[model samples]
Target: MDAVEHFVKFYKKLDNQSLTELALLYSDNIVFVDPVRKHQGLPAMRHYFAQLLQNVSTCTFDILQVDKADPTVTVTWVMHFNHPKLKSGKTVSVDGISQLVITNNKISYQRDYYDLGSMLYEHIPLIGSFIRYLKGRLAT
Candidate 1:
């Protein structure tokens, strides 16, 4: 399989057990960015995922589509996760896209684009209601 295919596969099966396989997919000097945080290097990325997985009860990614052009790959996915402190432990689904730059058959850079409010603020109690109301108003 190609790098993009490997990446999608790795993320789909991501969990505590699959963390050790990160090195196989990401370069040593990998740079990872998302709406909430930016991390550089494999060590930093590992630390971030470790903390993230520890807090969430369960997390999974469903790759909806994958497009690649030579060194660049874009993947659309839905992330489903349940956190004890968020949304009363109910599952939250967020749609997002990941842009990856592959080098030497390993992902060297990755950036994810997603709505911060939808993934976070919308899960809060009062804030969630207000955000939803605002979104509804803007839509119509």
Candidate 2:
């Protein structure tokens, strides 16, 4: 399969058991960056994913769209996850896009763009209220 197809399949089947597939999807020198953290190398990326999976009750990605240009692929998706510490254990959906740079059929660089407030800060009680209020005021 092609890199983009492999990427979509990887995320769709992502789970603790399938994390080992990271090696198949990413290169040794892969660089991954997102709103909350940046990791370099497959080992660091694995560590990050391990911690993330450990903290959440469930996490899944629904790919909305995919655009590819040779070695680069951009995918829009909504990540649905439930965390005991966030939103009273309710599921939250975060819309985001990931840009992947594939080299030799492996991802070399991956960057994600998403709202930090929606994914984190807005889930806190008092902080969430304040942020919503501020956003409401700014929207007018």
Candidate 3:
């Protein structure tokens, strides 16, 4: 498969929410970094995904651009979901950039740069309060 094909296949696996398919794209010791947390290895990646599935029911990724020649690729993504635990019920739309490093057709590293507050914590009830408190603290 070509670079774009591999990238799209990765997202296709995500859309299916197939753990087996998703796992195929990554190296055993994949490294993931984002605004909220840094995760290393497949086990850590599974933990991170478990948290995501706990809250989100449906999500779709949109691709904006591709630099096929380079092993590193960047994608624009917007995830849509509802969290049952947040404020009784709250839905969120999150926009972010997913930067991935692919080698030999498998992803070795993936870094997501997105706002945690907007993507998740803010809509939460008690957690939202705590996040707001932290925001206030940072503002000062």
lDDT of each: 0.89, 0.90, 0.72
lDDT by residue for model 2 (1-140), tens: 87788888877756534678889889999999998878999999889889988999988889999998878899999988899999999999999999999999999999999999999999999999999999999999
Query: What is the TM-score of each predicted model, taking all chains together?
Result: 0.95, 0.96, 0.74
Local accuracy of candidate 3 as per-residue lDDT tens digits, 58-84: 545665565544788877777666666
**lDDT value for candidate 2?**
0.90
Runs in model 2 lying further than 4 Å from the true structure: none
Worst 10 residues of 3 by lDDT: 12-21
Query: For residue 130, what is the lDDT in candidate 1?
Result: 100
- As a TM-score, model 2 comes out at 0.96
Lowest summed lDDT across 10 adjacent residues in model 2 is found at: 10-19
TM-score of candidate 3 on Cα atoms, chains taken together: 0.74
Ranking by lDDT: 2, 1, 3
Q: Worst ten-residue run, lDDT, model 1? A: 13-22
